[model samples]
Target: MTLTALFNKSIIVSGISFLLYFSSFLSPGNATSNNARLTSKDRVTTASPAVLVFSKTNGYRHKSIEAGKAAFTKMAADKNFTVEFTEDSTQFNTENLKRFKAVVFLNTTGNVLGDQEQAAFEKFIQAGGGYVGIHSATDCEYNWEWYGKLAGAYFLNHPGPKNVLNGKFYVVDKDHPTTKGMPAEFERSDEFYSFKNINPDINVLIKIDEKSYAGGKNGDNHPMSWYHDYDGGRAFYTAMGHTDESFVEPLFLNHVYAGLQYAIGK
Candidate 1:
């Protein structure tokens, strides 16, 4: 063959070989392709559940809401749980809530939802969904009976005009998952809450020692955290997370983390 022709033929053979090799690599049966196969197990780490955070309230406690959001996001990223956050309670419609394994009320307060949305949320919980309430979540839905029952209490009062001091948190049920990694009694600086008509039957996980705070209501039995079963659904609530400082605390974060996981059914 001519030298020029030989060179051209050699170039064509090289090109064809390269294409064949690329095609093989791209095939699903190839080892490289198999390595990329994504599984549900691969997406989540601890078989943790999914959680949705709903914060739809307008008031002076915006900081608390923001802190709650940050905490939920952090947990969602590292744990086996997924999180969806929104300030619109209307998004709690049946279809939207069905996608989440659990729902969280992040420092929400007052009448944030309309009649239809309230009814939908009630139904959602009754259907064996999970719920997690943080901080001022107790101050929410004062007129909704179902919600009050689910939350286990309503905001009756606060000692400080605003949350500005450190308070002691007393663990009522240290054996609970939410308190499993926490100390029996720990003092932290945050806004403490007192509830009205807290359901006595609900499992109380943590309580605030009223003696530690001035002008505190509910006396010495003030509950700081609780969990209960409502209409076939699991519910958790913590009076903590009133400040940005609370979210970053290692011990507090662990408590919130376990609560979120439990509410997600993990």
Candidate 2:
């Protein structure tokens, strides 16, 4: 071949090799593969909504950390939310709180937070951050007056020594997104908590009929789930989701998904 022709061929070959290398770098097996160039919409979708999950206690009741984690993983796939799970109160710092759009207390109990963490959480909520409490969250931080107030109630007690039998729940707020699709009266098996000093001002979403269980603190008016605006921030709580079975329930999962969406301002 002529020298000029050979040079042109070499240039083409070099270009082809470069393209192949570049393509390989962008392939799925690469560490940065999924980190592919994101469009504006993609960036928005993948942007973390910032959620902090506090699972500081197992309480005296059955602990289901794995169950909570599984549910959270499914929720995080939404691409609009990022979740961090921790049992350490030190993780509740001002900077950490500021990073998150919402904080979730997942099946926690007892005084799991110190004064600093408690203050940081209060400031976070007052500054318009969102809060979500699941299951035994009400059983936590009993001494902190603000915690109970924000939760809209404190765990006074529970009905049914075991939480397997079907029980009736009354839907108090049919219009709320979390309880929207749920029926007026539904039966489900799960540990239902009764709260003390349940702020009547908060919007009650679901309640339990006393006749459905052996012993309940709030009688027939037991509020099992609720949502409200507290201190300029949104808050949601559910007495459901005590077991692995509860998390898999379609209706219960839908309720949780709606609550998480609302909490993240979706």
Candidate 3:
């Protein structure tokens, strides 16, 4: 063959060799090599962080549950988190629970989860998962002791004739992420839940000014929102979101977002 023809063949041979070597670097399970310049589309896939919102109520159901779900779903869009809403206790299983970073008991009341399901939930928390109890969530699972303390408190009574009342909230720990950006004090019209056997270890984020409203039961120390580290996990609870209008309130939405962030350790 001619010298120029031989040189051309050699060039083609070198190009093929180079491509073969490069293909090995791009092979499955080997994309992390320094030589691999994989684009995002070529990278291994992962599920986005997700939260499960449970709103099951064997007792009285909240009229605001749908509003609460809508609010969270909107917030999740902006926060880049995924949210799944379910009233079915069957979703409380080892496999399904493992997929979530946080489980929110949104206005959940009465005995929502059965014994086996509750066990699964406990294990989920103990495995470093998060829990967020909203409004009537405090009224759930009265027979489950761990759930009571994990929820920060149990629902006892509220000021009523009517359970919903107008009250002023005091931001007890503004430094807490959940209470940060919150006003030092603000008035809200919702069900101000009275809790029984509140866990003192909980870091109170906001408290209600009993003197500002009637049926003051907890004296001056009634907590409206709180968070704490519990059983290898985190727990956040807020006695807010009782009314549909409350979910639309900017402050209340922010409060719920902050609580979720805290629970998820974001």
Candidate 4:
């Protein structure tokens, strides 16, 4: 070959080698990429989705709110997800709500969101956002009929003589991710709530054994935790988390995590 042709061939060969080397460097199995991967461990890991914890309440408020928030903040860090806690009603706007994979109502009570805010929230759910209601969240938005169905029930009453009581929890559906690893039967002491306007279609994950406690209103099938797909999004609600200690409980934390996962479409 002529000298000029040979030089051109060498250039082409050098370019091909360079491309191959670059490709290998980008491979996961490569050593140089390993250090780069370690530096970007967060990005290299699973996508860290975010959830918004909204504890707004116009009426009665639970003292566990702060504890729940703290626990959830820790949970977000440990589980590789982002959590933003807020009671501000303005956060309900579509633009703000879009940033969350799920919205968690932690111990919220009474009518919190206004008509416009409620509309935005409804739209958020319809757009495939997730919702997790803890404790008194069922007590909110009683006038908003759509929220009743979304929450699966409205808070009717609890044992008035004592807000906190002892009860035996029965796991009805062990197949659900939230209840999967939990014991079939367990005992817990907390403010158990009675529910009205409960949608019969909801899939109950856990129930309280009324016979184990006094002033049991719901009788044989008192649901403590349940989940269902509502509109275009997922909904999970639990009657627990009334006490500050409940937030620190390992099982309860796991339950919350699992509920979040389900709501986020994981």
Candidate 5:
């Protein structure tokens, strides 16, 4: 064959091959479902990395749970992550927890997890998973010594009348990423919690000025937000999400987001 003839023949053969490959998808036998076709060597799964938000409350449930969920969902979307909100403690298993990089206790109070679930979560943390606790998370699992340390404190009491709001947020560790971008001194209206058994090892990100509020039990250096590398994983806790309105506040929401990022090791 002449050089041009050979080249034309090759093109014809390539066209036939391309047509056949394209037609295969149009056939009924090549139907794609359940991500079967998407799970190939060159393709990654569509599932985004996610956080597991557990809001199960066995004690006084916070009404801001819904607001917390909404804010977390937005924050996850901003980072291209997903949020899985669950009230069922059964999801706290080795298999289920493996899907998430971190777990967020959004105002979860009292004994929410069973013995098995607790063990699974501990294993998850030991395996380098993460935890983010908000508001009443400190009020949870008082009998569980490890969890108390993870949450960094146990809730003692809030100010009198249960409405002594907008205490001065004094940045203690301003250089920490969790406190970065936050002002050195700003007032936020939250049902600020005084703490007991405050973990000495925790890196306090921010504290509340006791003199700025009514009930000041924790005294001068009352930590409101903190983070630490606990066990083999990361943990972040903030005691400021007590009201639904706090979720809408830009500073408070970003503070929580920063803590979330820190906890998830992002």
Candidate 6:
């Protein structure tokens, strides 16, 4: 062959060899491409997803809000998720809500969001966002029918702050991710709320045994926690985190984590 032809042949050979080497270097047995050794089913995400915890209240605010914040913060660290805590109603815009996988309403009450803010949040949920409501989250946005439906219930009455009940919490749906491993029934002390306008579509996860506590208006099969899909989004609510101690309880934290995880599409 001519010198030029020979040189072109060498270039082709070198190119083929380099490709072979590169392919071998990135093989499934290798670790360079991150989790390369694991199959698709075995692989897991390491990047943390984000969630927003909004605790604004236009009416009665729970003093345990701080504790709830701390609990979620701790959960993020242990569960491989990121959390942003804010009490600012102005943060309910599209730009602010976009980054979150879920928005957690922690003991929020009354009409927390303004007209524009409410519209923005509605858009978020419509765009497949998620919501996790803690304790008195059901107490808010009485005038906003869309929000009331999203929350699944509205606060009616509780036996007052002074009448904390060590109520028997009946596990209604143990199959749900939120209450998957929880006991059949557990006693917890907190202000049990009787809800109004309870959305008929919600999947009840736990019910409070009304007989275990006084002033339990919704006598038989009264729901205390539930979840539902609403307006193209996922929602979970638990009326259990009423006391500061609730945040520290392992069972309670796990329950909340599972719900939040479910909302985030885990």
- The numbered model that scores best in lDDT is 4
Candidates arranged by lDDT, highest first: 4, 6, 3, 5, 2, 1
For residues 43-156, could you state the per-residue lDDT of candidate 4 as single tens digits? 655467989999987898788999999999899889888899898999999999998999999989888999999999999999999999999999999899999899899998
Residue range 109-134, candidate 6, lDDT tens digits: 88888999999999999999999999
Poorest lDDT segment (10 consecutive residues) of candidate 4 = 38-47
Question: What TM-score would each prediction reach against the true structure?
Answer: 0.81, 0.81, 0.85, 0.84, 0.84, 0.83
2 or 5, which is superior by lDDT?
5
lDDT of all the models against the reference? 0.80, 0.82, 0.89, 0.92, 0.87, 0.89
Off by over 4 Å in 5: 1-47
lDDT of 1 by residue, 34-80 (tens): 67555544655434566788888865455757776777787777664
Q: Write the per-residue lDDT of candidate 3 for residues 96-178, one digit (tens) a residue.
A: 99999999999998898989999999999999999999999999898999999899889888888987788898999988777
Off by over 4 Å in 6: 1-47
TM-score quality measure for candidate 4? 0.84
| Model 2 agreement with the true structure over 167-197: per-residue lDDT tens digits | 8889988988998778899898887676787
- Looking at model 1, the pairs that clash are 166-189
Q: Whole-model lDDT, candidate 3?
A: 0.89
What count of clashes does model 5 give?
A: 1
Among the numbered candidates, top TM-score falls to 3
Cand. 2 Cα-lDDT:
0.82
Candidate 4 shows a clash count of 0
Q: What is the lDDT of residue 161 in candidate 2?
A: 54
Better of 4 and 6 by lDDT: 4
- Residue 87 of model 2: what lDDT? 84
How many clashing pairs does model 2 include? 0
Using TM-score as the yardstick, the better of models 2 and 4 is 4
